[model samples]
Target: MLIYNMWPMWVIVVAVFLYLSIKSYKERNAKDVIILMTVVIIFSFLTVRSVNWLYGWNIF
Candidate 1:
C-alpha cells in the first residue's frame, strides 16, 4: 500500500486534535480536555481503520 495516499488525511486529523487539546488545556478545563482527548483517540482510530479497510489492509 502506498502510504502517501493515506497519511495526509490522518495527519490533518491529528493536527486538529492537537490544536483543540492545546486550546482546552489553556482554558484550564480538565473535563473538556479529558473528553476531547478521548474523542480524538477514538475518532482517529476509527477513521484510520476505516481507511485501511477501504484499501483492503488488515490492521489487526
Candidate 2:
C-alpha cells in the first residue's frame, strides 16, 4: 500500500539517477559513475526498508 502511494518518489528517484548517470558518464570518470550507482542502490534499499518498518507491513 505504501509503495503504491509513493509511486512518485520511485519515479523521481529513477529519473534523477538516469539524468545524473548520463551527465556523470559524459565526464568519463569511472570512479564517479560507480559511486553514483552505489549511492542510488543503497538509498533505494534504505527507503523501502524504512517505509516498510514505519508502516508496519511486509509489502516490500
Candidate 3:
C-alpha cells in the first residue's frame, strides 16, 4: 500500500544528495560538486517521471 508510494523515500534521498552537494562545495573541487548536482537532478527528474507513469498523473 503506502510502501508502494515511494515519493517520501525519494525526498530523503534528495535531502542526502543536497547535504553531500553542500559538503562537497565547501570541501571538495568544483567539478566534483557539479557532477554530483547533475546526477542528483537527473535522478530526481527520473523519479518524478516514473511516478507520473505509474499513477498516470500529470502533476509534474
lDDT by candidate, in order shown = 0.75, 0.72, 0.78
TM-score of 2: 0.56
| Model 3 collision count | 0
| Tens digit per residue, CA lDDT, model 3, 1-60 | 454477667767777887889899999678878987987897688678768867899978
- Name the top TM-score candidate: 3
TM-score of each: 0.61, 0.56, 0.66
Residue-level lDDT for 12 in candidate 2: 73
In terms of lDDT, the best-performing candidate is 3
Q: What would the per-residue lDDT of candidate 2 be over residues 29-53, giving only the tens digit for each residue?
A: 8888887787678667766776677
What is the C-alpha lDDT profile of model 1 across 16-46, one tens digit per residue? 8868987999999888889778877876786
Worst 10 residues of 2 by lDDT: 1-10
RMSD of 1: 4.7
User: Sorted by lDDT, highest first, which candidate order results?
Assistant: 3, 1, 2
Q: Which ten residues in a row have the lowest lDDT in candidate 3?
A: 1-10
Better of 2 and 3 by lDDT: 3
Error of 3 at 53 (Å): 0.9
